[model samples]
Target chain A: MSRKIVRIAVPVLVLLFLYVPILILALYSFTDATQIGAIRSFTLKNYVTLFSTEELRSMIVGTILLALGAALLATILGTLGAIGSFYSRKRTSSAIATVNQIPVINADVVTGFSLCILLVVVFGVSKDSYIPLVVGHVTLCAPFVYLSVIPKLKQMDSSLYEAAMDLGATPAQALFRVVIPQILGGMVSGFSLAVTLSLDDYFIATYTKPATFDTISTYVVNATRGSQTDIKTALWALSTLIFVLVIVIVGVMNFNSGRAQKKEAEKA
Target chain B: MENNQNIIELKHISRTFEDGFRAVSDFNLEVKRGEFVTFLGPSGCGKTTTLRMIAGFDMPTEGEILLNGQDISKLPPNKRPINTVFQRYALFPHMNIFENIAFGLKLKKMPREEIKKKVKKVLELVDLEGFEKRSVSTLSGGQQQRVAIARALVNEPEILLLDEPLGALDLKMRKEMQIELKAMHDELGITFIYVTHDQEEALTMSDKIVVMSEGKIQQIGTPEDIYNEPQNAFVADFIGESNIFNGIMTGTMQARFAGGHFQCVDDVPEGTQITAVVRPEDIELTAPEQGQIRGKVISVIFKGIHYEITVQSGRYEVVIQSTKSAEVGSVVGMKVEPDGIHIMIAENNTNVFPVDMNRNHRLEFNGTELDTSLTQLIKGSRRNEEHELLDENGEVIDPEKIHIIASIEPQDIRMTDDVDDEQVLIEGTISNLIYKGDHYSYVINTDLGQDFIVDDEYLWNMDDRVGLILPLDKMRFQVKK
Candidate 1:
């Protein structure tokens, strides 16, 4: 009985430790409180300021667009790399797989600093062009996408590609028609991961972005250090909104996957 | 126009992998139009490799493949007018049955209505009518197999290559599909080239069967011809149950085997070394006094349609299949008709196997380390104290890069009854025996799946556990770069 109590108590304590701060901030976001440790009158003024501010709205839009573009590029490169490596000879494929893992396991700061050096110092590409920014994000995300896609390729029946070719489809046609659909699930998860990685990244963005541009992560850090209490409080509302969106998205994903698993079980 | 009947011809086709493992060697076959040709062999016998070469999935390392008298060896699978039904039904899981079947048609850019009509007709051909809208995952294995066949057939390929399409099916479903596929072939008049390890399936379906073993074709003949007239011990053993004995011609129309002299249909020069095959079903049991050879029934098994009896004579165990049952331990005489005996010239009486040179310059074969040196493999080469072999010019020879083949005459290897004897180099079971005039040639199969042929003047009973002693002086080694 005590062992069972420990098990339940431990997990509850850990979860509480993780969510308590976020819950407190969410609760405060709904009020007109200027600071924590004090309760002010209930109001939607923080949310109103969060949406009405032109600077915050543009920065959020710019960050989202950057993430979308980078994730798209990363997904294509990663999927193609995975398919190419999977079809290569054993030695070449394993060598490619090993090389692809280095970026995934390396420190993000190191990756960002090196990209900054390579693009700014060696190649002399202008930082204002946003090429280095997109390249850094793709470098950070593509390896992760490749890692996620390889298992799906391994799970797929390899003969399906040959079957398509035998049925008179060209190699490219077989790849697109038979191979891509089977690995689409892995690609989707990889794309979402790339997007999340791009959004969460701060060092790479800071190193590579233009001096005038600011992502949410950089803006939040700058905003907290500034003396503007209104914008700071508005950030609480933004954080609350992002947290709620994540919860809804995760919930829908779980529901969809559960239904898919149930359908697979029924088919079997 | 006389050559028009041959739709596809493989001339000296060979496929050696990058790692130097030969999958198919010098394979040649002429497949006639509308002919149901089957390549029959055990797994890793180059049957599927040959099929893949014909299907354009694999390219041969040497030789050309002619499709309607035109070389298509370098053509890709899509460019070739051939389709293959894979062993596992490789249906597109994301597509519905209709879309899967119409994939080739869509690639060809056929009209949508015609694609549908063709899909429907092929689906009915495979007995999967009205299954167009069903998703691939919703179908059973057999249903998916039909969909695969329908997908391949809907394109109406000039040649249909089946690589063990029914290998995944259960016995009953396999039997059913065999008949259905044969009927489909007959109705369509399409040339079918099939690869299978199952001999019964080949016999039941094929018009011509190519028996292959170890990347080489052992024999190519009709099913009746393959069964009744096997060309070698491998074919005799693979095609069906047969008692193969190494015999010698004593006189005209007379051969001596299994401790008995019998008249055979084959006429060879007297004293010629030969291997005789007698099928189990062709041997008749008679009273001991009236039989050509007398033996005691060691075991009897009821085999659904016949009783299979194993009779132990002096040094041989003869398998006989008959409708009548025999009591175990009862004496019986076995008589074989003259036409029942198939005579084949004995293959080379030497056992040759590939061996690797170890770091110590010793030879290794089939997990057994032999007391042979790499220096002995090359003439005028000697191993130094550092274990490196040096040639006559004193240049070091890399043992790792060299390929060593060891060959020993059958008579140079002796077998001992003590299986656990440490002095012996290998231990095996006596799988087969043939009496060749003054000596008995035995096929000893080791647990490692290597067969070593040895000839001894002394008689040994079949299935006797024995250890082989290879005399080093009598063993010859060949070194290849």
Candidate 2:
């Protein structure tokens, strides 16, 4: 009984350590605080101001669009690369996989700085272009997609493709009908990982973005640093909203999975 | 034989993998329509390779495969009118049972209604009619097997290949499926080519059995022929329990071995040497005065139907299966009828010598000319003095020359019993002694840089120096091209 209490208590303490500050920040969204360190009176004035402004809302939209675009492009390219390399010769595929892992394990600042040099100094990319920013996001996200997809490919039965072909399907038909459906779960998980990573990124975005285009992370950093305007409480509202959305999504998935298990048990 | 009646013919098929492994060698067979044939062997004996070649999943490295008299060796599996039930079933987990069975017809662009009708017909044949809507993963192993069969049968191929299809099921389920598969085969009346290593399964289900070992077919015959009339030592030992004795033909229908002379039913000439095989059930236990040989019982095992008894006679232990139980350590006399003894010419001995007879009536062998009578060289040959070893139609024997192959049986090479004489052909030290069920087979490395296998009824210690005696009648010669 004491051991079970320890197991339960350890995880609870860790969750509190991770989430207490986020909870505090969420509570600050309703108050009229001028800075993160100072407590202030609770008010709805910040929400009203946040809605009245178009720039902040546009920043949020821009960040979302960029993340979605990056995830879409990365998933397609990464899933294809994963399948192609799986059929390639063993030595070449392992070499390619090793090169794919460098960006994932490397420091974000190093990756961002090198990509900046490659786009601006090496390729003569202009400062106001979105190409550099979009390319940078795709580059940062594709490796995570590759990591997710290759394991699923390896887990699939190698004979399934031959079995399909033996059953009168051609090579291309077998690939599309049998192989792709088997690995779709891995591709989906890879796409979600890409999107999450893109949304949380600051260094790569800052290095590649033009001065006129401000993402949420860049806007928040710039807003808090200068005296032109105080950091808005609307940021806290956005954080709390995202936290609640994640919790709801997780709860729904768990409930559905449990119900599926019950149905299968009843069936058997 | 009508050409149309032979559904598939493999002519000199050989397969050598890229990794220097010879999986099958010079395999040839003709499968008649509506016949159930099985290739039975231990693992890596090319049984699966042969079945795969017939199904077009694997192509022979060299040779021709004819399906209905047309060469189908170069065709792909889909192009051939053959379907295989893989060892693992290989059912598509992503599809329901209905879609899985309909996949082939759907590819052919058959109408939906017609495809459904055909799939239902096959499902009923396999006794899986109501399993259409269930997911493949939800079904049991036996059900999955039936689905695999139904999927293949629905295609309506000319021939069906099964590669150890029941290997994954439990013992009881496998037995049930075996009966079901045999019944299905009878109803379909399609040619079935099955591959397995289980002798009992092969004997139970097949109309013909091809026994193979080391990538070569040992014997091909019906189940009764393969079990009762095995052609060689390997076949006799593999098919069932047999007590093989090294014997010499003493006279017409008589052989001498095991320190006793017994009457046999073989038609070999007198003074010829042979190996005799007798099944365990063929031996009779009787009184000492009424028996041919007597020995003490070594072990007795109570098998369900019979008592298996091992008797030690000299250095050999002979196993006998009888309905009457015999006490262990009791002395017993054993007798066998004349028909119980099967004599076969021993083949493929290591002590091989090339011999040829000249027109001058002299034999040249091993760089020595021997004065053997010419009558023995050409005796019982198809080509006698008139053809001079040529065919009767004057078609020269390939090179228009006669060559002879002479082999000395290892068991016939006797060691001198503490006496050295001019008949000592070789002196060697015993290198290894392996206790084959009936006798001790010894490997001897001689001073002349040769190895000889000798089956003896007397125990000899390893590394013992012994002089070998090759009896004149034991050295049998056969005509070769």
Candidate 3:
């Protein structure tokens, strides 16, 4: 096989494998039947109904709120951890890094089961409160933020800081005025990565989430469960919205990186 | 410049590392307010160590370093009123030229407008005007070196220490910077202490040259003094091309060598051996039998200005240089005056001390003193002499038991005896001829398969029949020890 054919074939194969269920769900929603591949007819009625439902509105609001809260919190913790660990000769930044990285690698069911035990059983977190879900989502996303920031932090020249200090800049001034500006692009990308991670998290949400709150991911899971339901239109709207969001966020961050690279090249 | 006085005084400075390496011995140096002194030597001679100790990077273990009359031995490098222009020009890569120059002034908290004015002036001083906005990496190597200099000089520190700043530059750039730095020195006069291994750089730029060797200073003087009157053979050989002749002191104004007797100038002890140095330019080539010295040409190299010739006479390989080229395989004579010979005691041989000895070298004949010119000693005595003729067990032969061959070349050799055919003859084959601007050197491979080099007045070609003679002055008594 030609190189181009193989390159296209692999991703297409994975896509075909992934989209089959979603395609079936869409076809059933348009058919006005929620039974898995039970009937095949096209209609927008399910999406219209979804728009009118009060739970859908609340779910969208809750998902946005959760993602923003988790992203903001993760960004702060991860940036601090990265800078502190990277700058110091002896610091515990790596310990926090390892702790967060464990969640990324652990089986989703294992992590969910463990967090459920910790928050609901050990900490006695009430099931109706949003605290356990928010805590779980933040833990899931912080590692992503830390990972994204690390490359940028390491790339920063340490001598610039020394030069600033030698030029009479106070330690704080040198950090903020010199170091922060140089690493700002990384921080932005890390925050964007955190938002993306928090938006897509569902496994942990399913196990430990409060009763009153629902993210879009968990809402989609529950919405597609019933029989004779218009699932296709609803999912298309959801996937398109999500796809656009990802593209926009990723595009802006990459655009920032391009400008920064250009500026660095000119300096060189 | 701080005060119109001594800017630095290093009192008995000595540095020892933790691993038991002594970098510099107990050395003392003083710098005036605006003097440009250069430390010159081969690598690892402790010149850079001395510079670092002054900059407060390396603390001396056993001395007081006073800057402006205050002891600064314990001060850290950053706190001292000095800066270094490193050999690599270690400018901050992240900063532009403007920031690099303004760094020290900014640390001093000078007002922004005044800092800008001063930085601009220094940039102009280094001929780096309009380079304020350029990143350090954008500039060429020479520009970076200049920026490093301006960065240090703009601070107006009491002293500036440069550790081989031009060592990385190419030849043309180096020469240009040397002239420019010397001009800058004349204009600023900021007590510049420069370190380098290039002797010509030291000779061209320094007001004073501190010649160092091993871990100690060999000599300190003006360029003329170091070149013309080196205190020892090491200094003479290190400073310029020299033909050194080792001999025993024959009392008040004379020393005997394999090549001849040298009219000595320095004071000598009662009984000691010394070595005299003759510069190639000071030696003269004459006829084979008529001149005061005799030798056969070994090889000749043509210099643009003169011929550099190596001649083998007696047991010594003497070098003569002149404007005229001579034919190879010919016996040549040489002449040397009293002023041309610089006598110094050899460093080895416990009997050869620095003091002048008796006027006549006395040889002991069965415990009785005999009147013999002490023209020679056992080998391995001069600093240039590396190894001895050893026995099978690798032990040095006892000085009294070995029959040593002798030096045969002198720039001025007069005929004292006829040429013995069976004995060693200066007559042989002409190997090469090199023409220098004012003279020529002839190389002749002898019939004994030994090569002889001679520098003479006449211009001669290859393969000439020549009778050979060895002057008594250039012949050494290599008697059994």
Candidate 4:
């Protein structure tokens, strides 16, 4: 019983350590206070200001668009890489998988700095170009996508593809129809991971972005850099809204997947 | 006429995997149209590999796979005019039964109505006509197996390959499916090639059984022929219960074994040695003086229909199946008729040793040397005690090379826990113990990768470390031809 309590207590403690500050920020966002420490009457004025601000709206839109584009590109490339690695000879596949892990394990600051130098000084790309930012985000996300999809590929019944070909389907049709459908669950989780990573990444975006443009993460970092006056009270409301939106999205997806799993179990 | 009748022919086909393991070697067969052929063997015997070759899943490393006299070996599985029901009924779980059955037809760009008609017809043939919209995952194992069959049959291929299709089913379900599959084969009129390790399944459903072992076809014959007239000891032991013994042919229709001479119908030459096979059910239980062979019952077990009794006499234990039960430890008599004995030339059971002798009047064979003055070089002058090759005049001479041959029957091998200086001893691990109806026959592998088949009444467990005592009297020496 004590061991069971330890198992539950460990995760609970880790979750409290990770999310307590965010919970406090969300709580302050609902108050009528101008600062985090002050507890005042509750109001929606901060949310109203957040939605009405043109700069904040553009930053949110830019962040989402950048995340969507990066996640899409990374997911496509990573899924193909995973499939290629899965069928390649054992030695070659292991070598490629090892190479794919570099970006995932590399220090974020080091990767951002190296990419900045490569894009600006070597490639003659301007620091303000969207190319550098998008490429950087993809580099950060693709390894995660590759990591997720490869396991599902390994877990899949390899004979399903052969069975499809035996049933008169062409090679391409077998891959797309039979192979992809079986591993779609892994692909979806990988895409979500890439998108989430791209949304929160600040160092790469800051290093690679144009001076005139900013994503939500970079904008928030720039606005709140060691100054109380520069940081806006409405930013808390924006953070709270994004957090709630992520929670709802994750909750709905979990519920749908759980139902699908239950239905599959019943079918079997 | 032959081309029309034979739907598929594998000509000199062989398959070697990338790791250099030969799965199937020199496999040649002409499968007649509408024939049911089963490739039966233990696992890793290349039966499934041969079936996969026919289905175009595996291309033979050598030779041609001709379908109606047209080579289709290089063709992919999708392009071949064949379909395979995999070991597990690999139905598409996401699809309903209707969609699963219609998969192959839809791939051919068949019209919706035509595809539906074909699917419905095949489903009805499998006796699952009303399970169209049911999800594949929702169906029981047997029902799913039928859907898989319907999926393959709806395409109307010229031949069908089943790789242990009923392996995943329960015993009862597998038995029922065996009969159903045979009926389906008859109804479809397509050449069906099935691979399975189950001997009963092969005997029950196959029109012809191809027995394979270690990538080579041992024998190909009708079920009855394979069961009764097995061509080799492996075939006899693999197919059904049999009491195989080493017998020496003294004359035509006369053989000596089990410390007695018996009459057999085999036409082996006089003095030729052979292995004989007798079925347990063929043995008759009688009084001690009324039968030819007398023994004491070692064990008895009632097997619902008959009693399986083991009788020990001499070095052999004769297994008998009779309606009358014999008490354990009771004296009994066992008799076998002349027609019950099947004789075949021994291959693996015969030991072959190269001839080598040094100059000190020593005969060297199997890493052992023996002092002997009787040495000759396959028709050269004879060697004397002083290493002198003596011609007819007893003069000192030398021959360039000597040829010698050695042969020993498997049962002549004596396995003991201790080594003796008087016997030629070799250490081997008991690799396999195959119970050929009554007594267990062991295949022992020596350190030099040579296998020795030893038959003894003693039941040695597999992987037992034992010493083989090969007495020199049992070893027959002959000049190499």
Candidate 5:
């Protein structure tokens, strides 16, 4: 019992050690209305100032649209790739799997730097365009989607596809009706991963992203660098909203998948 | 099912893989309407290949496949009036039982109401009606198989092809499904082309059995016909346990075997090699003096319903089964009626030429001039190896070129305690003896990996080196036309 308590204690101590400053920042965001050492009372001015600025709203909308679009695309592509490779012969599949892991293996700073050059030099596209932002985000986020989907696809039973084919379905029909539906659990996870990765990606987005494109991450980074104390509380408010929405989506998808699986089991 | 109504006919069908290995060749079969025909063979015997050809999954390299006299070789699987139930019942994991059964019907664009009714009726037929809305992932294996069957049946194809469909099921489940499938066959009256390696399954479920090996049909007949009247030694030995002996023709109706002349029923010409088939059930055991042939009981095994006794006479091991048990050490006499004798030409056709195999496995045909390859080798030798039996050396002889001879009865070869330089045959003991319900198989421990499979009524024990009997009837005409 003492050992169990000790095991729990070390990790908690480490977490507290790391999160103390974040906790302080969160508290300071509400009270940073006046200069330091005064230690003035809490106010919502910083939070209110964020809402009052039209640019903040535009940046949030842009960030949300870019993240959602890239994440959704990457999720579908990764899932299809994973499921496809799962059914294929080992050598061809291994080659494709190697390609899927390339994004993660490449250093993030290097990828951001290289993509910045490619977008501006090769495509000659403007740096601040939403296309560059979405492109950069998808490049950074797709590997996470791939990583999430591959495990689920690997765990799937191959006999199910054979069963479907033997029962009079064409190869194409089997892929859609049997293969895709069976691995949809993986699809939700892959989507979540891509979305989360896209929402958090700033290094790549900041480098090649359009001038007007300030995702939540870039906006916060810029706001902090510029010493704009007004938007600090609003950043917290925004993080909480994103966290809540992600939780709701995850819970709903999980519940939906569970129910569907139960129904399938009963029918089977 | 076999009353001259041909439903599917395979004419001169041959299948050779791209690697140039022939899996099946010149396979011909005519399936009567609604008949349950089984393709039974050991692994790599082209039985599954034959089934696949019928299902349109594979095309024959030569000749045509006709369905009801209409050529259907060019048709794809779905276009053909047939459906296959695979070894693993491929149930759709995503679809419920109702949707799975209805899938084919939906493809046909049948009315929604009609599809629903058909699906419901088929589900009821498979005893899974209430499971229409339940997902496949939740069902037990048997239930899933039924769903697969229902899925195929709902398509209402004229024929059903099952490739070892019960292979994956447990023994008990397999037995149950066999009965269920047989019942389903009767109820539906659709032609079933079932492929299986299990001889018992073939015998039980099939109206006709096609025994195949090495891409060729060994025999095609009813179960009774196959068991009672085997065409060759392979067929006889394959269908049931058999005690085989070789005897030289003493007269047109007589054979000289084991230093005894017995009255035989075959009409082989004088001087030709002959094979004798003795089924175990025909050999009656009796008291030592009263029996026609006397031997010592070497082994005894208890079957669920009968007792199997093995006896050794000189070098021969004869196995006999009876409801009554016999003491292992007792000496017994055995009796076989003249009518129990089966004679055939003692040779098995093989693709392997005699020259390529090891000398220890060599076979002796009466004459060697008939094989073109052998003739060519003999004509080409620089310093000719002696043809030992020839009076004068007209051509070269190579030990590698000699053919491997097959005797009619494995029991005809008598074992010897010592190898005399003049004696070409080797010595061995009864390493393993099996009493099949109908015959006994004895594996001689030649220790050369060339252990011989001999059949006889004499039951022998392990570690006994008995004289090998090369009965006169086991000799064969070396020439092939």
Candidate 6:
């Protein structure tokens, strides 16, 4: 009985440790407290400021746009890379897999600095253009997409492509009609992962974004370092909103996967 | 050219993989229009490879493929008038049955209404009517197989290639599918090229059967001809149950084997080495005195329709299948009519036996340890410091997985009159002999029932006891992976 208590208590403690700070911030965002030390009466003032402020709104919108664009590009490139490698010869496929692993394991700072150097210094591409920023995020997210897609490709029946060909579909038709649908689930998950990764990234955006524009991550870092009390408190509301959005997304994904599993079991 | 009845012809086709493994070699076949030809062989015997070549999925490395007298060797699969039903029923899981069947029709830009009608008609052909709009995962294995066949047949190709399409089904379902598929073939009258390792399925469904072994065709004939007159020992053993014995022609119409003389129908010259084949069902059991050869019944097994009996006569075990039952341990006489025996000139008169290799890389034959090492079995293979055999890739090969067959030519074996000689490996009685131009070929039957065909220059009397001297240098070993 004591052992069971430890097992339950251990997880409860760990979860509390991880979520207490976020919970405190959310609670404070509802109150008129400018700082965490004191909690005043409840108000919607912080949430109003978070939406009414033009800089914060544009920054959030720009960050989402950047994430969507980068995630789209990353999903395409990564899916193509995975499919090409999956169909290649054994040696070539394994070599490509090994090469794709380096970026996934490498430090984000190194990738950001090297991409900045390659695009902004040697290539002389101006920072005023957001090319380096989008390239940096795509580089960061594409390998992860490839990693997600490889497993789905491996799980799929390898003969489906041949069957399509045997049934009079051309090579491209087979790939688009038969092969793509089988791995579309992985591609979707990979796209979502890329969006999240781009949203959470700070170092790559800081090094690569245009001088005049700012993403949420870069703006948050600058905002936290300033002495603007009102804006700081409003950021709390933004964090709460982001956290709620994440929870909703994760819950929906889990629910969908669970339903899919149940359906599969019923079919069997 | 347009009036030719041959649908597809494979001319001297060979396929060698990148790793130097030859999957098919010098294969040639002409598939007549509307002929239900089956490529029958054990797995990895190039039957599926040949089928793939015909389906335009694989290109032969050496030869051309002709479709209606036009060379289409380099044509893509989509360009060919062929469709294949895969072994695993590779149906699109994301699609409904209607969409799956209408895929090829859609590619051809057929009208939507016509596509639906065609799908409905083909589904009816496969007896899967009213299955449209159902997801693939909701179907049973047999149902999925029917969907696959319907999907292939809806295209109306000139030829349909089926690569063991019923291999995944249970026996009863497979039998049902076999009859249904044959009926479908007859109704459609389309050419069908099938690949299967099951001999019974091949014999039951095919108009022409091509038996293959080790990337080569052994025989191509009708089912009746293949079962009645197999060209080689491989075909004879693979097609059905037969009692094959190493024998020699004693006279114009007589052959001596299995320690007894019997009259055969083959008109081979006297003193010629031959292999006599007698089907199990052709042998009749009788009283000991009224039969050609006598033996004691060792086992009697009741099959569903007949009784299978094994008789041990001298150093031979003859298997006989009959409707009547026989008492085990009772002596009985077995007789084969003159026309029941099928004889062929012996292809290889060498003595070959399976040998095992121990961890120490020593060769073991018939449970007796020999002085030969495992490396001697395969040339270019060497033993490492740990006494494990290393293949050409320097990889340690498992001794148990390698099938080692040691063979000694008839000319390489020496017979000794002294049964207790030190160099003698086995002692046996002289069962049969054939006189060649300058030498004599003898079949020695050991007590373990193994036959050793040896070529000797001197004369040996009948029933004389002799010991075999297998010289170490004269024996050749082959390793089958």
User: Considering every candidate listed, which one attains the maximal TM-score?
Assistant: 1
lDDT tens string, model 4, B288-393?
Answer: 8877788889999999999999988876778889999998887877778999889887555577655465565455665677543454433456756665656566
What value does the lDDT take at residue B400 in candidate 6? 76
After superposing candidate 1, which stretches have Cα over 4 Å from the reference?
Answer: A1-4, B1-4, B352-407, B411-469, B473-481
lDDT of 5 at A33: 44
Better of 3 and 4 by DockQ: 4
How many steric overlaps are in each model, in order? 1, 0, 58, 1, 39, 0
Estimate every model's Cα lDDT from 0 to 1: 0.90, 0.83, 0.72, 0.83, 0.72, 0.89
The DockQ-based CAPRI class assigned to model 1 is: medium
Q: Candidate 4 or 5, higher lDDT?
A: 4
Candidate 5 deviant stretches above 4 angstroms: A1-5, A14-30, A33-39, A44-52, A110-170, A243-268, B1-5, B11-26, B56-64, B170-173, B231-238, B243-279, B289-293, B338-344, B348-481
Reference-based TM-score of each model: 0.88, 0.77, 0.60, 0.85, 0.75, 0.84
Docking class of 5: acceptable
Error of 3 at A90 (Å): 15
lDDT of 2 by residue, A1-268 (tens): 9999999999999999999998987888777776677775788766676666788788888999999999999998888889888987888799889989998999877888888899999999997999888898899999999899999899987767766777788778888888888998788889888988988889998898998998888888887666744335676677777788888977987897799799879768
The residue-by-residue lDDT of candidate 3 on A54-167, one tens digit each, is: 777678778888889988898888777787778755436667667768877987667777888998899898988888787887788777787878887788665456444434
Which number leads on DockQ? 1
The model with the greater DockQ, 2 or 6, is 6
- lDDT tens per residue, model 5, B178-258: 999999999999989889988888888889999887688989999887776677666776666776655567787877554
The interface RMSD for candidate 1 is 0.7
DockQ of 3: 0.14
Q: Who wins the lDDT comparison?
A: 1
Worst 10 residues of 2 chain A by lDDT: A224-233
Cα lDDT tens digits for candidate 6, B1-481: 3434898888999999898767898999998888999999978789998888888878889999999889998988889899999999999988999999999999999999999899999999888889998999888999999999999999999999999999999999999999999999999988999999999999999999999976889999999999999997778878888887778999998999877788988899999988888899999999999888999999999998999999988867888999999999999999999889998888777789777887767887655578876665577788788877888889888777888888999989999999788788888998666543235668798766678988887999968999888888888887766
Model 3 lDDT per residue over B244-290, tens place: 65567787877777557656566776357776778899888998776
TM-scores of chain B alone in all candidate structures, in the order given: 0.81, 0.76, 0.70, 0.81, 0.73, 0.76
Worst 10 residues of 4 chain A by lDDT: A224-233
lDDT of 5 at A8: 100
**Winner by TM-score between candidate 4 and candidate 1:** 1
- TM-score of the A chain in candidate 3: the value is 0.77
